[model samples]
Target: MRAVRLSVVTAAATAAALAAVTGCTEKSDASGGDDRVVKVTATDSKCEVSKTKFPAGHIQIDVENKGSKVTEVYLLFPDDRIVTERENIGPGTKQKVTAEVKEGDYRIACKPGMKGKGIRQDVTATGSGKVAKRDPRLDAAVASYREYAQEQADETLPKAKVFAQAVKDGDIEAAKKAYADSRIGWERTEPVAESFGDIDPKVDLREDGLEEGQDLEKDWTGWHRLERSLWQDKKLTDRDSELADQLITDLTDWQKRVGKAEITPTSMANGAKELLDEVATGKVTGEEERYSHTDLVDFKANVEGAEKSYELLKPVASENDAALTKELDTQFAALNTLLDKYREDKTSYVFTSYDKVGKADRKELSDAVNALAEPLSKLAAAVVK
Candidate 1:
């Protein structure tokens, strides 16, 4: 009886020791011992681990969300496989997830919050049970943004031609009104305008002279020359006709220079859809804490596209399409105001945690973006029609 009691006590003590080491009751079968703990810290800059490579074994990943918002940690396998996902980890919270990793490469990504930014790190398994570190996904995200910028450039040019024709047909007022209506689709392209450089000069806005209260010299700048021309006196001469013809030729040349700045609503929708898809797939990783300077470019492109489109469609609205013209005019005015705000708050409209922004400021910024989309969408649909 004494020998049996001693045996039971020894077994119980061993089990307790194992639980203390593993942080769980289950014993690891991979290494025949529970000894490895992979610690990952998710902070402002990255998802970093003390070691980058790990050996094949039963491993415990202890993730610490040190950022301002909730974060999720995902372990990804080579075949686009997600070995495991842990979610809803609040700021400063720590959670431990265990996985049986074989001899292979794996990725670790942490998404801070819904619609928030994400970061990633790579880990390699070695023979001696060490982890290798790599963060290639960061570069991958930047490459993706550049590709998107090129795609936007490809879609803007043809649309500019239709816009110039509207101006040449002695329909400056109609053009002005239509330009206002096409803001949404144009705004998306605005973020990439600088990439195209001096393309707006191809659209000629100088054929008409300034009218009362509308000074082209005061208001006109590059692509915005069209808007400035709108308030000019409605008179045409032989010289003006020649100028208009020249303007059309210039616009065609500009379109060729800029490529296509006009991306259809369908295409814009598709791009947005792709962005959302990447976000959902845990594939969207980049530094977006700052307002994507690209957003400003998109804003400008949209303005340019709208200005050109308006030049083309203004006549239709003024003659046979009065109702459509009036609706477009109203939408464009609101959009112009929105663009003004964007220009003013270009650097301020960034994506950071609520904690990083003052309460009133955050609300105001969020409201501005939210307000613009619906009105912009309405305008885009009208212009496309």
Candidate 2:
């Protein structure tokens, strides 16, 4: 587990819950008896989604973790592609999320302890699968985000290859330098990458993200695995070289598939919040770039991606909730200003290693992240309203 240096809002509180599609959902009872709202009761072994069938548009999931561990909920396509998800739901916490789903077979999966494939319940959406008519600006926002995701994928492959080549050549110093650079594009468009269901685990999964009983030599083969070789292990292996090739292969698949991802204004809004959650859980905690201490680099990219989403949705969100937009603007500026102070080179993205950062400073960063996150949680609702 990553070290938690300060109190920060969990992903459930800061990012999860509200997601996808058009229209607001009517409130429902928390028990597994709600008719309109899809009430989900998650225990260690069971994931109970109240109604198996519902109307096609405006799908809402009201999740309560009656389990002993932190859990996650997902709306998955029949092929297991993630439509949208809410992660890090602590025991006894309740989350309400809404997503746009077309008429299709789907699964509501809940992962207790936030690990493994999760207990899944079959679900389907009935009736005309058409989504509610979205505003023109929201449509434009989806289009723009799709383009941005593609661009990030298009750029990531080459940079990743650079890191891969350095590893293949067994050049430790070069590999170290290229590692953080390659990850920037991935961090920027993480949500789009994650929508694929399979790619992120293959290309970016950290060692700790592995399921229980998974062998490191066999199961752990991604950026973090390679990262250990360059930094902590202080050595390279023939397997590391093979992993470098596999990383490129996985990324190539991601680049090819990005255009097919489902992008909605609400998804973008939810994704922006997810980015901030990454900062709080991984980057701010110094667990993401643990050996490299390049958390700040990833931190910056996450914020930039979140800001881009917010900016794209601002036109519509401001109209729906001007106060939220204004508060978000102030918070974003505050966070950015705080981050800038850590940068030794304002001209470049590099910053001081996180290990050098004091505990109080970390607390300050965590607070800034939480301050922005509270408003970010309302982003999906604002855009859809």
Alpha-carbon RMSD of each model: 23.3, 5.8
Candidate 1's C-alpha runs over 4 A off are: 1-139, 181-186, 198-221, 232-385
In terms of lDDT, the poorest run of 10 residues in model 1 is 12-21
lDDT of 1 by residue, 20-125 (tens): 0111113222343334566889865678887777666456778788999877676655432334445557788777665545566877777765223247778875
Each prediction's Cα lDDT score?
Answer: 0.42, 0.76
Highest lDDT: give the candidate number. Answer: 2
Best candidate (score: TM-score): 2
Cα RMSD of predicted structure 1: 23.3
Positional deviation of residue 151's Cα in model 1 after best superposition, in angstroms: 3.9
Task: Give the worst 10-residue stretch by lDDT in candidate 2.
Answer: 4-13
